[model samples]
Each structure stands twice: as structure tokens, then as C-alpha cells.
Target: MSGFVAGGPPPSGQTSPDGHINTSPFWPSIDLDALRGTLRLDNSISPPRLETAVIAAAISVNRELAAWRIEQQAAGYSKLEEVPGETVKGVPEQVHLYRRAIEAATGAEVCERYRSYDTTNSGGKKADDIAPNIDDYRRDLRWAIRDFLGTTRTTVELI
Candidate 1:
């Protein structure tokens, strides 16, 4: 037999490029392959785990936007896409920002969970190095959600 495998679907643990992750009825479904490619996630993450992370991210994003969503619905915009936004490339800016929020939240969740995958001394150091990145991911998430909600990122606190 040749080294090349016969044509077929991806292995059990791998994700199909055409797969989509459905979100709440008001939100758009996310493209699984697009997220994996954009995040540079590889097959090391099984499809189930990837799906779990994506779902968690979606839930978090939806919760954060819950009030805004209700307001939009009251205004007669039945879906997220129906809410007006500037077009970026061929997509609406709100959709892009919403996707970005999900991706950032997923990145943070994955990195935090995988930090313990390796327990060697070097792995400990690696985990330390990733700490700042996790914070950055969180920051990105906040910015995306705020942008989607049409709010400023700054926080005012009396000190």
C-alpha cells in the first residue's frame, strides 16, 4: 500500500472545515474552521474539546451582551445582524466584533486550561510566560464586546 491514505473524512478527533457552531437564535452561527484557522489551533485540540471551548465562549459573550440584545429586540431588530453597523470588507462590523469576542474568550480559555498539560520544569516556565498572554486575550475580549455594544473601554473609579 502507498503511504498516502485513501480519500475519506477527517479522522475521528479532527474537525471538519465545513462545520458550523450554532449559537443562540439571535446570534449568528460561528464557522468552526474559520475560528481554528484564525486562532492557529491545531489537531492537538480534539473536536469535542474545541466545541466545548467555543460554546463556553459563546455563552460568556451572550451573557455580557444580554441587556444590549434585549434593547435591540425591543427596537424591532429581531437578530444581531439586523442591528445596523458599518460594513468591514464584506461583513458587518458588529458581526466581526462579536466573532472577535468569541475568539478571544476561547483563546483565553484554551490557554488557561492547557497550561497544565505539561508538568515539567520547562512547562512551569512556559505557563508563567503565558500569563501575560491570557491577560491580553481577556483585554481583547473586553474591547470586542464593548465595540459590539458601542461603548467605551475606559472605566472610571474614584480613588
Candidate 2:
């Protein structure tokens, strides 16, 4: 058998075990395992790449929400999780939105990186297939951020 089998699990130690990636003081930490499972990310994604993508996403999300966060803090809400939102199974909805935003952003980042990772014909075809996904991922990220900010996703302005 060849060294690499299609659909086979990646060799061990390619990714980290279940763990947490700490966020800023005002944000909830992200669970690495949850992110991987929720996004259906396979072992093909290396740990370093996954971590880098996630950190980049979090930084982007945090920067995008910085103004709102400051306002919330001035209003006596010091943490993103403390913002008023419906709870699911005792977990705040804002937390879900935040994670969703990160996941979507990470997906986009991964897709973008993958597109440039290979130049072979198969790789090109795969990149083409995923081209639309990048947009969708970005859209989802925007919606999630909007939801977290309690803003409407669309703003239809008359021309």
C-alpha cells in the first residue's frame, strides 16, 4: 500500500489534542476540539495552520467589534459573554455567535490558503470548487458578527 491512502486519517501528532485557546480577558476562550469538529475539519489541516488561522480570525473578529466592546464596557458589561442575549442550554447566545464568526472566518482563511498551497491540476480543480465557499464563509462571518452586535444583516438603501 502507498504511504498515503485516500481518506485515511492523518498520522498521529499532526494536530493537537483537545485543548483551549485563550482569548482576551473580555472574551471566552475557544475550544480547539470543538472548532475542528464543528467545522468538520479533517486531519489534513495541520495543527500550526489551524491555530494560526483561528488566531487570525479571533484577532479580526475582536478588531471588528472593538468599538462596540468599548461601548458595552462603558455600559457596565465587561465581557462579550455578559451581553444580553438568549441562552442555549445555559450558554449565552452571544458566545455561540462569537464562535460562529471565528469558525466562518477560519474557514475562509483555510480555503484561501489552500488555494495557494498547490498548483497541480487536481489542486486547481479543488480550488475552483471551493472558490464560492470562500465567499459564503465570509458572508457567514459577517452575519455572525452582525448578530453579535445586535444589528441587522442587511441594510437596503435606496439608490
Candidate 3:
């Protein structure tokens, strides 16, 4: 048989930049392909509405991921602690990392909401004025989510 197929190159013709095979026997499907069609609608409505919905969805997913991570960590710690006399100090570090990751992912959402509220009520407000409250809220939310995820350890460091 020839090296090349009738329609195209062989299954292993070439590798992609990521070092994976370029060809797939089966076609891949995307769940959000419908959203692409929404973009082709007439301009009767503003585009910012769609942008806002996408952002909201992203924020929700971020929160959910953080909650899930906390739950996973808590389960791990519980299993570790169940061993008689075993100590799990790394749980604190893991919790800290989880909080940091959550903040890093959602900081923009918190800042944007603060800025929007401040701009609507007050004439002008710098990010510094609202940062303390934002940090406090983030800490509180992290603790709440962690606790909800089965973490009995209440002491949390907000740094």
C-alpha cells in the first residue's frame, strides 16, 4: 500500500506542535458550539450583555472549582489524619495554596464588582480604598467554602 492515504496523509503523517498525532480517527465534538451561532445575530441588542453573561459564567465556574479543590483537600487530610497519631501539617499549606489560587483566579471579579458599585454611588474611588474590604470578603468566602467542603479546621490565615 502507498504511504499516503487516498484522501490525505497517513494516520501518523506528522505530529502537531504539542507533540501529539495530528490525525484523529474520530471527530471531536464541542458542547459550546451553539454559542458561536449566537454571535452571528443582528445588532439589535448590545454586545456587552453577552460579554457580561460570559464573565458571570466564568466567575461561577471559578468559585465551583475552588470549592471542589477544598473538598478534595479536606478528604485527603481526613484520610491522612485517620491513621492513629498521624499529624497532617501540610493541610494548612494546601489550604493556603487553594485560597491563593482562588484569589488569583477571582480577584478581577471582586475588583470589577467593587469598582462598578463605587463608580455608580461615589464620583471616583481608587482601588486602594476598596481593597481592604475586597480582601476581607475574599477571606470570608474562602473560609465559608472550605468549611462547606468538610474542613473542620477553622483557623485560616489571610495573607
Quantify all predictions' global Cα lDDT against the true fold: 0.80, 0.81, 0.37
As for lDDT, the candidate ahead, 1 or 3, is 1
Clashing pairs for model 2 are: none
lDDT of 3 by residue, 75-107 (tens): 663321222232237444433333333333243
lDDT of 2 at 33: 70
lDDT per residue (tens digit) for residues 53-117 in model 1:
89999999999999998998999998888888789897889999999999999888877876877
Of models 2 and 3, which has the larger TM-score? 2
Which candidate ranks first by lDDT, i.e. highest? 2
Clashing pairs in 3: none
lDDT (tens digit, per residue) of candidate 2 on 100-120: 999999889988887877799
Local lDDT at 94 for model 1 = 90
> On a 0 to 100 scale, what is the lDDT of residue 111 in model 1?
77
TM-score of each: 0.86, 0.86, 0.28
